[model samples]
Target: MRITALAAALVLVVASAAPASAAAADGTYEYKLLAKAKPDECFNGIGVPYPAGPPCAEGQPKVNQAYVWGLTRVGTDIWFGTGTNNNCLTTGATLGATKPVLNADYVCEYAESQMVKNDPKIPPEIGDVRPPEVWVYDSRSQRNTDLSAQIDKRSTDDKYRRDHTIGLRAAGNFKDVVLLAGPTAEGYVNVFAFDARSHRYLGSTTYTGYGNVRTFLQYDNALYLGVGVGVNGGDGGAVLRWTGSLKSPFSFDVVASLPVQAADLSAYDGRIAATSWPAEGSVNAPEKMAGVWISPLLADGLPGLTTEDAAGWKQVWNARQYEPDKVTAATYGMGGVASYGGYLWWGSMHVPMKATKVHQKVYPQDTDEAKQAQVKGTQRATSIFRGKNLGTPDQKIELVYGAVALPVYDGVTKTWSNKTTNYTPLFGKSGFDNPYNNYTWRMVVTDGKLFVGTMDWSYVVQDIVSGGSQVAAPDPVGYGGDLWMFTDPEQKATAVNTTGMGNYLNYGIRNMIVDGTGGLYLGMANPMNLRTDLTDDVPEGGWELIHLTKSCK
Candidate 1:
């Protein structure tokens, strides 16, 4: 569906304004629901008509979950990628011999059925792959185009094929070219580039060495890439510099090697700072742990952007300094990082069920009751932190949303050992005091204000294994993901919308970007595919795109 600017503005929802204060901005945010994933079109294969018949075989369940996986912007065109039935794919990827519980949420049919239908000889490591898509929405024309359709017809260039792409995880723009990338069935990262102005396919390439790619940072008028080189990003990480022409659109040169996977990157105080993911064996070593690291000063020359300055990076803070248990701390992955008000701000994240895995490994549980206890004991919320004068003797760091003491697990004693967090939050507890806010998904600083997007697990806490049992949970504080804003770090955060912008099923904000106008674009994540009864109160599952404009009083 296409919505004109005038029509979109007519349906805008003006959110409640913050409390009056000297530091507060006297205004409310007005948002418009621009688009939603079409249930019939999103899951259809390339060149296939809407409502494409039934599954290949009966009794074999169809993967139904769909959501926006990646998003970026060029000019007035918003480009995003989509994936379907991801929960099913994840189940197949994780469980080999172990069978998962029979849950309505997901079924690992990809390995047993879906793969053979596509290719019997495909590698098991990438057997769950599906055909993902790239789409571009022109803000000016208010028309959405599926770029994947054009690629599918390019029979001459096999590089443009989308048959094997599981999902596009990241989108970026460099030198007037828009790039979309995701993992393929061959266990490699495949990237496709298109002309930003013409919207024509340029080329595509697969990086076999990098198993995972996260974010793309544009700093000092140059583009830098962050990726993981080992299986599932468990070995090490590297930062790459783009050095390609139109002929070789996928060319990149290594800039730095990290002890583990690099997740996000930010520019601060004339240097680059990065957040990391723990390696397979780096949980106990402070120097090799997951934390914040800073690079040497990037001058106008090629020193910092080349391999010559790889050794000049320094680890300023680590997980060991925050959480007491090394294994649990390692399970706390790092999320969005950015520079705001002369300080570098970052936060920790809990990959769903990760802490439970760590707990079971540390203290071998023999029964279902013991396993449930481990899950309950390891449940944790994310914490936010900020630092100043990093890498200097006078450097200082403080918790922005953390506790003085947190529960920890001891492997040797096999008991819960609570430990001091070492610093108190300047604002309040982690997840803004809500334990279910597991991910600080994305953050952006605009107009002297910081906007934080979070993944709240409140809606599905009962459906998933997160609660550790089949017991009921209290009705959630509110359904959907949350959006919070901070006019000043010294003041409390104002809730922009805790009900996922009126859609109780929109679980999180996966991607957010400023429009360079007085507006922001949000890509929402909603994977509740089983709830297809639109006649009811619940909204249809999949993804939604919203445009929010700030209106001052």
Candidate 2:
């Protein structure tokens, strides 16, 4: 009788070993990888073939523009993660005309379908899911359906995210040590962990309601500290917490809250630091600015930055006030902060509030000197067709994003100072006049170096005066702000990296993510996802993904 009972117990144990559905296969990739989707053979996502009809017959080849919202390196495979940011392809400058620039940022959402699932609607409810998701490219199978249905599910977070910076720390080449995803528009951040050997999701934790995570950090182990976006724009929100017990599913708790509005958090040497938001209207509405805040790597009440405190704990430095005279805030939605060159940096992104683009832009007739002779022989006239830059550049005045480097030594005292300034312009905005004043939506700089990623393109800058040479309006004198990079220590950046990413629709500058390798992931509205231009496939609506190997290097 004892032997027979033991056999029964063994059977039950074997049955309970069923794999967890949320957890991928033993070798399934998690949040770190870039993989392309399968393409449809006959119906393409482009101008005509998709929703309305195939564009091939109309002389418009169906091409896809891809934009990447974020990147997750799961296993050895690198995934350019993103979702259909908007009906981007269809949202063209003109009502009916498609936006070529935005369209190139990514293949349409419909186009991504063939690559993942064959079912009509996916698990996440196509419209409900968020972009910037992790896809496993290494496990591609001819039967695209081989992947778990999670990729197809729609998102439940806020509609779209304006901030693209995600906090990431690495353990090794294939594993993403930690990924703290904080969307600017919402109050939730998804925590994901990768097991290098197993290549799957080991654990996940979700923290809800933190206003907007302006910035966060994955300190020590599972501990994540988030700051920014006060509650309903109130005084400020608390420094919450999320705990992962290492059990199958995880839970979170609020350890402690602070009175000050912290913007971003910096972690190093087992200690954590942060900056507070200035008065509201100060940058946009200074009356509401909160100032800077700091904390230890281990928050109050929490033992340490560990898997137990996934949500976070209380304040270590408490809240510190900022004096308007000593510090200034950046424009709303135009400011950013980064940790590089051994300090935390903050800056405001500036762009001319005025529209500098003319209805008719001057285009060189041809590269051949002979073909360009029309400029030398023909007498210039002021007619509309005469070809001239009509509008004056708001060059020096392009909107300015406030900036400051944390742990930076003040020039006079040579002490670590957290100063704020209005303007991402490193190459003296006062020096030149550019007809096409490029509005810098996003930028990064440190050690007297700079990198500017604009809504149009990217650029690296050097000497402010030398860089902004005399030139006609459209090609802004300051070498046009592409992805700007300033690696020098003596001054900020004024040049650009020569490499190119798709430019047509550069909206991702307002929404982007950076990886451990300093790769900047941008999302743009793309047309390549449309099956047809007329079928309402969102001819110009999609996303684009660009990989900048290194912003500082």
Candidate 3:
């Protein structure tokens, strides 16, 4: 009898193991390659494509633009925004010129000036701005339409003479209209309206304060905008509420302000939650580090009763309180935030290229201290946190996803404590076990599941190599942005798709939206014009729009 029971147990073990292995082999989701943008697509209806050579020299047959940064769904059609390869404009120019320009401060400006001088058709006021293109894909008809010209016409600013609009930063459906925010030169954020029913372009409103509008959310019948002060000078960041009729679309009210840049804003549990960039300095900094704040719920249960002051908001989480001993200071600027699974989910931002010493004095990149700082910055994995009962004072917050267990530092004691405890990483340590995938660009909840999109810097490392930088290459596993879905609350994260949805040039999944019909759309970020060297499949590097759906067994 004992032998027979043992034999049955062995049989059960084998049967269970076989199914688990097969499931692993089958993968959780099937990926379909949807569409690819070409180099000529950037020039479509805009301006003539620059002749091959010199500054505009081709990496492939045709230099491709990168990023389908903006994505939104209206009815059955999906609208995506594509960004130009600003790197092709100048060797030093970066996307949105985010980096601090040291040597030639205006390389992109200089290149634009030269392009205007050469091209007869191109106006000097517009310069050589290769504005982002807008495309609409009709899922019902399976057709695509280029709406770049219509969007451009509505955003034209004769005062600035800079008609070239960058990629759409945020998009949403509000009151039967699709609102799109596009930023141009000199801290101008242009908001455009489109009739979703007729797919027609409406008028646009241009705001002067914020350089870029990063995120948008609709609550309490009002559209809230999160604006960032990029390279342009401003009084940090502000949250603006749009409360106007169709006839007067430009009316806005400033609701809140922060000392640093406002990274993102989201509506959660009848209140608005916001995150900001880190302030300067280390131990005794004048301004506080990045933090999560919730506005007091008004009588209408909306988040706009107070102005931009301490008394108007309640602080929830601060990076300094969670800073690890490995780094001098924690600059935990929050990224995407959303309400999911009975909790508010938020992600951290840790871009190594943007990492710098936050305490004491600025350290030079060549010094050992600076190099260690860079490693420490990269080691600061993007963490995912969840808070339950967000608005109430009894709210609880916990780290749901992260890899490293950094030792907590005690300011008064001046010692490292809790080295072995409380530093639990839900995800395995080391950049979620993929070093290059550090920044969580966006997060969204759909069909009762949480999906996270990341920005992998492995391609940026390769771009550095192609541009003759001394930094070593990153690991192969870290090449592309990864999409992770949290379905079973108890199970590990399921990787839906990883190969940048078939475009290897895609380094970041900047935006994602649900199609309302059981489908998810992803926007790719491939800034440095990448082409597939192995095959001629895509000779020019361009951004791609990818759609994901569950496969039938």
Q: Which candidate has the top score in TM-score?
A: 1
- Assess each prediction's global lDDT (C-alpha) against the native: 0.69, 0.32, 0.58
The CA lDDT at 301 in model 3 is 33
Per-residue lDDT for 1-553 in model 1, tens only?
A: 1113212211221111111111222347867788876543222332222243343221322334366777788989999887665555554564232232333333334434445455764554434455777889999998888888777776645434477667887788878878887766656677888888899988677787886776777788777777777655656888887877566788888887887777788888988888887777767677667788888788836644677757777889987798876777777778778888888988887865666665666677765554554555566677888899999998999899877887676666666656898888888877776666778877888878788878876565545423223333234345567777888877878878776766766778777888888568888877665445446544666678888788754
Q: Give the number of the best model, judged by lDDT.
A: 1
Q: Where is model 1 poorest over a 10-residue stretch in terms of lDDT?
A: 13-22
Off by over 4 Å in 2: 1-67, 72-80, 86-133, 136-148, 151-216, 220-242, 245-265, 268-287, 290-293, 296-331, 341-343, 349-427, 430-454, 457-481, 498-504, 507-553
| Number of the candidate with higher TM-score, 1 or 2 | 1
Ranking by TM-score: 1, 3, 2
| Ordering by lDDT | 1, 3, 2
What's the CA error at residue 397 for candidate 3, in Å? Answer: 2.1
Measured with C-alpha atoms, the lDDT of residue 258 in candidate 2 is 51
